[model samples]
Target: MMTNTQTSSSTERIAAEAPLIERLRAGDDGAFAELVSTHTGRMLVVARRVTGSEADAEDAVQEAFISAFKNIEQFDGRSTLGTWLHRIVVNAALMKRRRKRSRPETSIEQLLPQFDDGFHREKPQSIEVVTNGGGGSIVEREAVMAALDELPDEFREVIVLRDVEGLDSKSAAESLGISDSLVRQRLHRGRQALMKLLERRMKGIES
Candidate 1:
């Protein structure tokens, strides 16, 4: 759920973007350039996460921008333009993934914490996947991305949408065509798997 302040800020941003959206709908080339320049990098990041390759991600972002341009008039003021574009990019990436044959994925169940008959972890270990980084270091960011990339597609998608992209459970569920309960379950298991991967990476780096 969005806080009052977040809702107000989003509303203000949408209001501010009204003129730009109008220009886009009017097919103003300069306005389109501005939109592309402002959002391409962020959109590429989302695409890369979803498609898992630079070339495919770039294609996905390009397709998303073209689609967004074609449908600019249909965009209601319910969400900011950036948010709308983000959704388009994600959809494009998902479509690209469906078109391409994906590599074999690792089983997330192997990474999840196992429990015995008493509901106790058979081999308990602390798993902490830092979603919000206190240290904004490039190395830390890369580490997080690396760990995220190791997860299976389903698990990775859930974590990226919820933890990295800041989507609520309901929103993520809607985006992925999954239930709210499944989103929560995937998020929990994904974070645990990610934490284990990150810890191993950090230890390897230290060694």
Candidate 2:
């Protein structure tokens, strides 16, 4: 949830950017370049999380900028310009994923926690804590990213939008063209799968 101060800051930032928005809408090349320079790195991070390829992520960000320029008139002032660009890049990345060679979907049931007759997890001890006691190092971060990359597209996208991109359930649902309930379901299952994956990776390292 956004605090009142955060909300006010965003509003002020948007107001400050009114001139740039006008210039962008007017097809000013300099304004467009400035926009790309200002936001490309962050946008690429969003794209990379969803697409999981540097080349694909870059392509998606480029496509998003083009789309944003062409549709500048559609940008209402309700959100900050950066937020608007973030959504565009996410959509572009998802579209790129759809166009690529599809991978077989992994069974979420395989990743989900299994229960016995008494409704207790069959291997409860197998579930390891996600966080390292020490602040996590780069290797741990890479391992977590690898685990995320292994998730099926549906699960990965939901987690990236909700957890990685920090979108609310409503916002994530709106971005993905799904219902809020579906977003919640996917987020729950995706998180479970991620935890399981991380646990396996940690165990592998210990062995």
Candidate 3:
């Protein structure tokens, strides 16, 4: 049986769609609540990937929601509502990155400490295959997450949108405010960096 919370959440989501579509056209209250509930989770993930910090991600999501609410009427409804919202979230995240980069802070290169060991880079073996073969332990998974965190913001955003969020290259590019070629370029570089990180970790296990 569905719990009261589940029922309420489901009902709210369902009720949101039609009302949201209408209210967005006319600019009404339901538009805001509807969008917030529907897109917040995915938007947060997008923001987190771009900003690489939980607090910054939360702020970016909030700003994105506010911007979307204000500009709802401009939405053409050609794409899924989620896609529009994802674009807004990406814009917000990129703005946050701009602000941070503009501030006087430690340069990313300066922040990195030298490593004493060498590691090889290779094509990434599939995580699913390795895990199913009982090759990945909890520590391995943590290392992968850590490597993702180390990626440059541009590389990280494309990776999250494409691989993690399952967005196509065109959609991901639209969301990131970049061209398809740039999206492909970023994804390629991002994958290479991730593969290098993973290979380094795997080498640790072998040694």
Candidate 4:
């Protein structure tokens, strides 16, 4: 979530990019180079988190940059150039994921929170994958990333877009070509599965 200050700053940044937008629309080489220099690092991070492969992430970012340049005339400027490029890189990475993999994914049903009939050794809800309210050692982000990679693709993509990369549910749905409700459902289950995986890993570490 963005604070008022962050929202104001984002608005100012977009406003500042307006002149560069004009230059981009007019096919200025320097403006396009500036856009690349500005956004590539973040784009690579987003791509890598989704695809879970450094090579794939680099390929997706390169493809996205080339596509953005070719499609600059069609860019409407409703989103800042970075936001537009982010969306493009996400789509590009998702495409490569589809094209690069042909393996069966494990079902996540077993990893979901277990049921208790007023009795169980422990409740899964008590576990916090990101931070525990009990002030336990916070789960490392590298651990969380590893857990995310174990999720089935259907669950992983929504989590990456909405939670890890900070795109809103609506934007995540738009990027993944799914409905908002579907995004919510997947994010919900993805988070639960992630927590369960991290909980198991933490127990192993302690043991």
Backbone collision count in every prediction? 0, 0, 0, 0
lDDT of each: 0.81, 0.82, 0.70, 0.81
Q: In candidate 4, residue 69 scores what lDDT?
A: 89
lDDT of 1 by residue, 3-100 (tens): 23245688788899999988888889999999999999989988998887899999999999999988888999788887888889988998897688
The residue pairs that clash in candidate 1, if any, are: none
**Model 3, 207: alpha-carbon shift in Å?**
16
Q: How many clashes show up in model 3?
A: 0
Stretches of candidate 4 above 4 Å error?
1-6, 9-12, 116-122, 125-139, 205-207
lDDT-based ranking? 2, 1, 4, 3
Candidate 4 residue-wise lDDT, 1-207, digit = tens: 221323557677788999999999898889988998988888999889888899999999999999998998898877677778888999999898879877767578977766677565464444553245334444466667878877898899999988877778888887888999999999999888887877766555431
User: How far is 122's C-alpha from truth in model 4 (Å)?
Assistant: 6.2
Better of 1 and 2 by TM-score: 2
RMSD of each: 4.7, 3.5, 8.2, 4.0
Superposed by TM-score, candidate 3 places the C-alpha of residue 56 at a distance from the truth, in angstroms, of: 1.3
Model 3: per-residue Cα lDDT over 150-186, one tens digit each: 6767777788788876777888888877999999987
Q: Which ten residues in a row have the lowest lDDT in candidate 4?
A: 1-10
lDDT of 4: 0.81
